[model samples]
Target: MEQEANKKRKIIHIDMDAFYASVEQRDHPEYRGKPVIVGGSPNSRGVVATASYEARKFGVRSAMSSRRAVQLCPDGIFVYPRFDVYKDVSRHIREIFSRYTDLIEPLSLDEAYLDVSVDKQGIGSAIEIARLIKQAIKDELRLTASAGVSINKFVAKIASDMNKPDGLTFIGPSQITGFMEQLPVEKFHGVGKVTAEKMKKMGLHTGADLKRLSENEIKQYFGKPGAFYYRIVRGIDEREVQPHRETKSAGAEDTFPVDLTEIETLNKELERIGALVATRLKRHNLKGRTITLKIKYSDFKQITRNQSLPFATDDLEVIVKTAQQLLAAVDHEEKAIRLLGISLSNFGEVIAIHGNSTQLSLFD
Candidate 1:
């Protein structure tokens, strides 16, 4: 029954290619076929949010420093982000998803997971639904989106990235295991650069290599995420497409032009960030019991410290004082602080479901 249920579940992952850069290119015809980068200025201590395919050819990538991006793609065009416009476009894209299924889980403005086991249009084939959706975005939004169709979210997400702009990939149930076995450990969703390197150092380079370890052994090595690696190696992912994923936290941060070592400077910056967090919480009418402070050193090593208050708060004074206290406790006498952030979480509220709720198929 479990195997049958897994086989019957139809999942699709949709990801827009270079969403921010693509949108800029679509709106500005002159940017077509050119290296367009959307983010802070190259001269600033800002990072690249997105880079066009042309820019990527020069090795410029998202999250890379804008200064490095400029060095890589000297002729790249830099444009500030237009989030409002992107959000509007995202709404249109979600509307397109709604035409086929209401079981849509938006991972971000540029990507989403869709459950079409029982599509609204009664289009039984998940592959066909993906193709049509891709075509619709191209025709109506003048943008390209890649899609992947499979039995579950994990495989579907990996498949979606396998193809490039305007591509669609369909991985059937029978192909899942073989595909996973051959996959590099680095390709797993939660495995970051450090984890991948550690895995490779341990002679575990692929899913097949990981499969050689017992679940307990993997857990002992990788901690909590090891159990996930164990199951995903065999293509066993039963996670659902949740339409109303909760907003885990709200926060803001800033990257400094020059790293600072002074306690006074750090305290002032934390005050500013705390005020921003307070404003955001009040804007959304949210009060969180836990306050977290993220610190990034000059060498790019990062750490986080959090304190849970006896009560939830959205007050600027409370937020600022708490963040300052957290910063005060960190022993950073020699380390230069390059970035500081504050966020509030643990909202004591029921998670609300979005969309027009629909009945799941018998398979679900």
Candidate 2:
């Protein structure tokens, strides 16, 4: 019965093509077919949010520094993001998705996962449902979307990116094994540049190579995530599409313009990062019992240290003090630090004390 249900599971991953840039082009006829870069000013310390296909041709990409984007594509038309407009568009797309299935999990404003195993529209085929959703978006919103249909989320997400703007690809159970085997290790979701380099060093360059390692051997080398890799390579992703998934964590990180070796400078940086996390916690009305400090060395090696407090807190002083304590335990003196980040997690209902008076918990 379990095997039958797994076989019957139908998932679809939808992603908008260069969402922000594409929206800009769609609204402005003059910008169509031209490079569009949506982000901060090139003169300031900002990064690219999204780049149009035309800008991508010049090697400009999201998360890249605006200064570098300009150097790569000098003629690129840079524009600030209009998040309000994007959110409105996202709501409209969600409305279209509701016509098919309510089991929709939004990954971001421009991407989502839909479990159309039993679509409300009475569609028996997931592929057909995906086509209808895409057609609806194009017809109603005048926007193009790419889709990937498969039996599981992992396969579906990978398949969706196989094609570009206005593309739809499906991976059936029979095709999953071969499709994953030929995929590069770097192409696997959650495998970053650092992990990919480590995988390559271990002679694991493709999904096939990863599948050869036993679960125990993979875990021994890569820890918990290794077990995940072992199963995913064999097309075993049992994770569900959660529509109302809670925010597991919220944090901020910044890559420095230059690596800092001085303890004083590192401490100052941590103070700023801690304050940012605290501000966000207050904004979201969240309190967390665990505080995590993340550090990346000049060589790109990263480490995270976490400390759990007796009670959840959103206090700036508490966050800063906890982060400082965690930083003290790390051997930062041995290496130059290129990045610093602080995050709070392990959230639950707890008494929130404000100005010496207890207030209602946000979770309540």
Candidate 3:
């Protein structure tokens, strides 16, 4: 019965191509077709948020240092992020999505998962719905988007990235099993660099290789997440397109241009970060019971320390004080710290407003 119901489901994952960079290009005609890198200036310690396809050809990628991106694509143009404009554009895009189905789960400002199994327009065909959505984005927004249509979210998301800008891919129930078998293990969405390396070392290079292991054996080797791998490798994902997903946590952090050694300096930074988190929590009417401090050393090693309160609170003073205590408890007196962060989690019961999901959501 479950298998039959799964076959009847129609899922679509839509991802805007190099979203930040593409928006920059659309607004600035001069940047069109050029290698546009959006984030901080190359001279700063900031990282690339997004790089145009042209820049990607030169090995530039998101989260890479802006300095490294400049080395790879000397001709690339750098632009500061215009989040306000991007958010407005994203709002318009979601409005377009609503014409088809209210079962839209936005992943970020530029991507989403839509369950069009029973569409608002009675389109009946998921492929047709995907095509129409892509056309509408291009026609109305003057921008292009890529889409993946399949029987499940995992397969649809993977299909969405199979092609580039303005591409559409459909993976039907009949094709899903073969597609999974031939897929590279690294290409599996949740498989990270370290995990992929471990899989390769074990001669588990493809989905088919992973399929050889029993569920218990995979768990023995990979721990808790191995269970997820065991199921997805066989193309069985039961995750839903939740339109009103809860906001699990909220926090803010910054990467400094130079490492700091002084505790005072770290505390001041924490004050700033804590204030940001408090403001975000207040904006969303949420108070958390756990406060966590994240520290990354100059050498890139990272660790987190968390403390839980008896009562949830979003007060800036409380957040700052707790973070400072966590810092002091750690042995960071001699270590040069490159990054510091604060986050509030374990909210007793709080739901983010629709369409305002966290950027860290796996479905996004």
All candidates: TM-score: 0.77, 0.79, 0.77
- Model 3 earns a TM-score of 0.77
- Candidate 3 wrongly placed segments (more than 4 Å): 250-304, 307-328, 331-364
Model with the higher TM-score, candidate 1 or 3:
1
Evaluate residue 64 in candidate 1 and report its C-alpha lDDT on the 0 to 100 scale.
68
| Candidate 2 colliding pairs, count | 0
Candidate 1 Cα outliers beyond 4 Å, as residue runs: 250-291, 294-304, 307-325, 331-364
RMSD (CA, angstroms), candidate 3: 7.0
Span of 10 residues, lowest total lDDT, candidate 2: 355-364
In candidate 2, what are the lDDT values of residues 18-115, reduced to their tens digit? 98898899999999999999875777545577899999999998767678889999999998766557767888999999999889998767899999
Most accurate candidate by lDDT: 3
Ranked candidates (lDDT, high to low): 3, 1, 2
Off by over 4 Å in 2: 1-4, 251-292, 296-340, 344-364
Candidate 2 Cα RMSD (Å): 6.9
Higher lDDT: candidate 2 or 3?
3
Clashes of 1: 0
Counted clashes in each candidate structure: 0, 0, 0
Q: Show pairs that collide, candidate 1.
A: none
